[model samples]
Target chain A: MTQTSLTLCCKVLCVESDDDKPLASPADSLALIAQERANLERDLTPDPRWMFWPWGFAWLLGFGLFFLRFGPDGRVFVDLPEWLPLTVLSLSFIAAGLITGIAGGRSAMQTRGPSSRQGLMYGLTWSIAFTGMGILFAQYGDALPDDRLGLLWAGGMVALTGALHMAGGAIWNDRQLFILGAWTSVINVAGILVGPGWHSLIVALGGGLGMILAGLLGWLRLR
Target chain B: MSDGTELDPVIHAQARLRVVSALSVLREEDKVTFPRLQESLRMTAGNLSVHLRKLEDAGYVEVTKTHQGRTPATFVRLTRRGRLAFEEYQEALRALLNPTSPSTSSEETL
Candidate 1:
C-alpha cells in the first residue's frame, strides 16, 4: 500500500487506447494483484550507498594526518602561526551545515515523504549543526589553542555530518545522500590541505549547489 | 418520499461505495482531482463517470471541470447532504455492530 506501489497499480490498470473512453469491465483484477506483488518486492530492496562509516573512517584518516603533522611539535592544526581567519572560516562552515540540515529536513518531510530530496535536506541540516558547534567550541572555550582546536573541530564535524547523511539516506531509502555525506568528509580532509580560503569555497559549493540540484531532481520527478 | 430515509442497497454497491470513500477523504479539502480518484479507486474513467452521474443525480456530490496545464481535470467534492448521509451510515453501522449495547437498546425502545 505504499504510494509508489499504488501508483504503479494504477498505471498497470490503465488501457492504452486511442479513444479517451473507459473500459467495459474491470479488466483483469488478477493482473493488478500480480503487479502489486512485484512492486512490493521492488520496494523492499535495500540501497547500497550508505555513507556514515565511510565518512567516519575518512575523518579518522584526517585525524591521523593532523596528529602526524603537529602532534610531535604539540601544535594543533590552527596553531601553525595562522591568524584568527581560520576561526572565522570554521564558524561559517559549521553555520552552513546547521542551516542546511534543519531547513532542508523540514522541507523534505513536507514535500515527498522520504525521497532523495528529504535525504539531501537532512544532510544539509546536519552539516550546518555539525560544523557550527565545532567552530563555536574552537573559538569561545578555554580548551585548546586555535590550530589544535581546528583539527579537533574538523574531525568531529566531519564524523557527525557523515552520520547524519547516513541516517537520512536510510530513511529516504536512497544512497545519494550517503554519497554526499562521504563527499563532505573528503571535503573536510581537502580543507585541511588547502587552507581556509579554498575550504570555504568547497563547503559552499558542496552544500549550496549540491542541495539545489537534489531539490530540482525531486521537483522534476514528482511534478 | 415524504420522510427522510436511507439510500437503496443497490445504489450502495461497488462503484458508489468507492465514490463514497474517495469523497470522504475530501470532506475537509474543497475538492479532489478526477484523475486522482480514478487512480485511487482503480476504476476506468467511464466506470467512474457512470457512478459519478448517479451521485450527482442523488445530489450528494458536485463536480467542477478545469484545466491543469493543458489537460482537463475534474474536481469532485461531497455536498452537505452527502456528508450527512455518510455520517448517518457510519452511525447505523456502529449501531449494527453493537446492537445489544444499553444506549442502542434504549434508542430502539424509544
Candidate 2:
C-alpha cells in the first residue's frame, strides 16, 4: 500500500482509539489527562487585579452618586454648578475605564489569549446603554413627580447594572458575580419600594458593599 | 490498515505526548511560557528543557526565548506539522488497537 493510503487506514482505526484511550498504557494516559485538566484549571482562574476594577468602580461611582443626591444633612450638597457634578461623574468613569483597561491588557498579555475582548465589549455596551438611558430620562422625566423620577432613574440604573453582571457571570461561569448581580437587583428593587428618599443610601450601601465583598473573596481566593 | 508502524516516534513518547496534548488545547496563535508548561506538567525545569529541546530539534515544536521585564521567559508552541503528526500518530495507534477488525483485513488485502 502507498504511504498516504496506509496513513488514512491508520486514521480510521484511530477514531475508536481516540475515544477509548490516548495510549496503550491506561495509567500513563490517565496521568496525561490529569495534567491537561490542571492546565485548563489554571488558565480559567482569574487574577486578583481583575476583581479590583469593579470594586474600585463600585466604590467611586456609588460615593459620587450618593454625594450628588444628598450631603450629610439629607439635602443637596452643591447647587452652585450642574456642570461640575457631571464633569466629576465623567472623570470617575474615565478613571474606572483606565483601571480596567490597563489591568485587563496586562493580564491578557500574560495569558496570551482573546478573553479580555469580552470584558471590554461588555463595558462599552453598558456605557452606551447608560448614555441612552440618561437621554431618555431627560426627555420624559418631567412627566413624573421629581422625587418619583429620581427613584425610577436610580432604580433602573442599578437594575441594569445587576443584569449586566448576571449576564457576565452566566457567560463566564462565575457564581460569585452571578450572586452579586442578583443581590444588587434585589437591593435596588427593595430600595425603590422603600421610598424615593432612600434610593441613594440603598445604592450606596448595596452596590458598594456587594463589590467590596466580591473583591475581598476574589483576593482571598488568589491567596 | 494495521499500520501501527506509521506512528511518529517523536510524539509517541509519554512526556512528548503530554506536552503536545497541553499545547493542542490552546489556539493556534497562542504560545505557552516555559514556567507555565512546567507547572502544568509537574516536571522539573531541566527535564522539560530537555524534552522541549528534542521536540524543537525535530521541528515538532517551536521555542522562543524573550525577556519579561528583567527576567528571561521561554515560550513553546506546536507547529502545524507537529499537530498533523500527532493526529496521524493517534490514527496509527487506533489501527494498532483494532488489528483484528474487518477494516484492517481489507487494508491488509489491498
Candidate 3:
C-alpha cells in the first residue's frame, strides 16, 4: 500500500531473461522502459543537421554581402553594383530553400500520415507567409521615406523569418529552433534601431552566424 | 512472483520486449522497415527474424515483405490487439511491482 511495501513487491517480481539473468527492481524496469523509448526516439526522428546549415550559410553570406554594399549614411564599403548584393542574397536563399526542400522531401519519402502531411503543410506555410509579406511590403513600399525603405525591406524579412522559425519550433518542440528565431528577431530589431547598413552587419553577424553555430551543434550531435 | 497477474509471455523476453517497445513508439498505423528495426534494437537479422516470427504468430505484430523501388524489404508494425496487449502487459508489470499501486485503486475502491 505504501512506497516501501511496493518496493518489496518489485523485489519479488524480478523478471528473468531467457538465460536466467535476474532483472532489476520494478522501478529499474520502468527506467529501462523509458531508456528504450528514448533510444527509439533518437533513432526514429528526422535529423535536423541538413536543414539548419543551409539556412545558416544563406544568412551569413547573403547579409554579409548586403552589409558590404549598403553601409550606413550612403557610405558603401564595397562599391559593388546596387543589383549585385540583392541578387546574391536572393540566389543564396533560393539555394538554401532548394536544399531544405529536397532534404525534407527525402526524409519524408517513406513516412505517411500526419507527420508527412505536417511537413508539407509547414513548408507551404513558409512560402505562403513570405509571399504574403512580400506582397504587403510592395503595396506599402512607396509610403515610407526613401531612406527608411531599405530598413523596412531588410529588417522586415529578418523579423518574419524569426517569427516563422519560432512558430516551427513551437509546433515541433524544438528548443534550438525557437531560440534561434528569438535571436534573429532581437538582432533584426537591433539592426533597424541603428538605421541602414548597420542593420545588415548586425543581422549578418548575429542571426546568420547564430544559425551556423546551432547547425554546427546539430551536426556534432548527429556525429 | 506476481500479484495474481502475469506479464504476457510473448513480451516478457528481453529481446522481444526491446523490439516491441521500440515499435510501440510509432503510431499504430506507422511501420518500421526490418533493417531500421534491427538497427535500433541492435539485433542480428536471424535473431530478430526468429523473435518477429514468434510475435507474428502470436498476432502481436504483422510482418510484410514488400518492395521499395526495386529492392526487396520487410516492414513490421504492431497490430491493434498487440498494442492493447502491450498496455495490459505494462499494467501487469505495475501490478507486480506493487499490488496496491494507484492504478488498481479505482477498481479496488469499495
Candidate 4:
C-alpha cells in the first residue's frame, strides 16, 4: 500500500489490528507510546510568554506611575497642594484600571483564559509587595513602626484590593483585571494613611502612567 | 517528519496536538480520564479513542482500568518515555523557530 493510503486506512479503521483482544496489552503498548510521545515532544513549543505579559505590565505600570508621580523627584502635578497627592494617586489607580481593561482586551484575545488560581496568587503577591514598600517608605519617612493605626489601615486596604483582584481574576479569567482590582483597592486605603502630600505623588504617577504605558504597548502589539 | 526521532505527520494533526497539549498541562500526580481528555479536546469518544489507541500502541501512554463505583474508568498517563519524547519534540520545534539558539544544530534547526 502507498504510505498515504496506509495512513488513511489506519485513520479510517481504528479497530485494533490484532483481532484476538479488543483491549491492548498495557505492558507491551506503554513503551512504544512513550517513544512516540518523545518524538512528538521534540516538536512542541514552550509556553508563550506573551500570554502573561499583560498582567506583568499592569503591575509594573501601577508601581512605576506611583513612584514617578509622588516620589521626592516627581514633577507631574507640582502645582497641587500637599493634601492633593493622595487623591491624585487614588484617581490615577482608578483611571489606570479602567484604561488597562479596555486596551488589554485587545491583546488578551490571543491568549487562553487566565487560570484563576494563578491570577489570585499573582494578586496576593502584588499586594504583599505593595504593602512592604509602603511600610518601608514609612520607616524612611522617619515614622515609628509601632504606629498600629496606620499599619492596620494600610493592611485592610491591601487585603480588600487583593480580594477584589482575586474575584475579578476568577470572574473574567483576566489576570490584568485581577491586578487592577488590587491596585484600586489598595490605593483607596492608602489615600487615608499616606495622605495627599508628596508621598502620594509617586503612587499616582506609578499607577496612572504605568497603565498608560501598558495600554500603549498593547496597542502597538495589536497593530 | 518521522526520522526515528520526529513524530510522523500522521500523529501531528491538530486534534492530536490538542490532546497532547492538554495532557502536557496535567499535573504529574494526576492522570487524565478518557472523558476529561475527550471534552478538553472537543472530540467524540470514538475519535479520541482511536487517537488514544494509536498513542497507546506507540508505548507513550499507560492506560489504567479502575472501578469508580459500578462503572469502569480509563485513565491515561504519559510514560517516562512519552514525557521525554514530548520534551524533545518541543525542543525540536523551538529549534525550528529559533535557529540562532545554541541548542539548535546547524542543519536541522531551521
1 or 4, greater by lDDT: 1
Give the best candidate by TM-score.
Answer: 3
Better of 1 and 4 by DockQ: 4
Please identify model 2 stretches exceeding 4 Å from their true place: A1-46, A49-57, A60-90, A110-120, A141-146, B1-110
Instruction: In candidate 2, list every pair of residues with a backbone clash.
Output: none
Question: Could you tell me the lDDT of residue B36 within candidate 3?
Answer: 76
Which has the better TM-score: candidate 2, or candidate 4?
2
What does candidate 1's lDDT look like per residue over A1-223, in tens digits?
2323322232333323213423212232223323433332222222121112222233233333444334434535444433334443445444543544445443332212134344566555754775578567656556776555555565556557656766766775667766766766777678656653344444445543444455455444333
Question: Which whole-number lDDT from 0 to 100 does residue A20 have in model 1?
Answer: 44
| Better candidate by TM-score, 3 or 4 | 3
Query: Per candidate, chain B TM-score?
Result: 0.80, 0.81, 0.87, 0.81
Which numbered prediction scores highest in DockQ against the true structure? 3
Per-residue C-alpha lDDT of model 2 across residues A54-73, encoded as one tens digit per residue: 65465456545655654433
For candidate 4, write residues A96-153 as lDDT tens digits. Answer: 4455444444322212223324434554665576666666655544444323433343
Give DockQ for candidates 1 onward, in order. 0.03, 0.20, 0.27, 0.04
Query: How well does candidate 3 reproduce the true complex, by DockQ?
Result: 0.27
Give me candidate 2's interface root-mean-square deviation: 5.5
Cα displacement (Å) at residue A219, model 4: 17
- C-alpha lDDT of residue B45 in model 4: 98
User: lDDT per prediction?
Assistant: 0.50, 0.67, 0.76, 0.47
Error of 4 at B78 (Å): 3.1
Clash totals for all candidate models: 17, 0, 0, 37
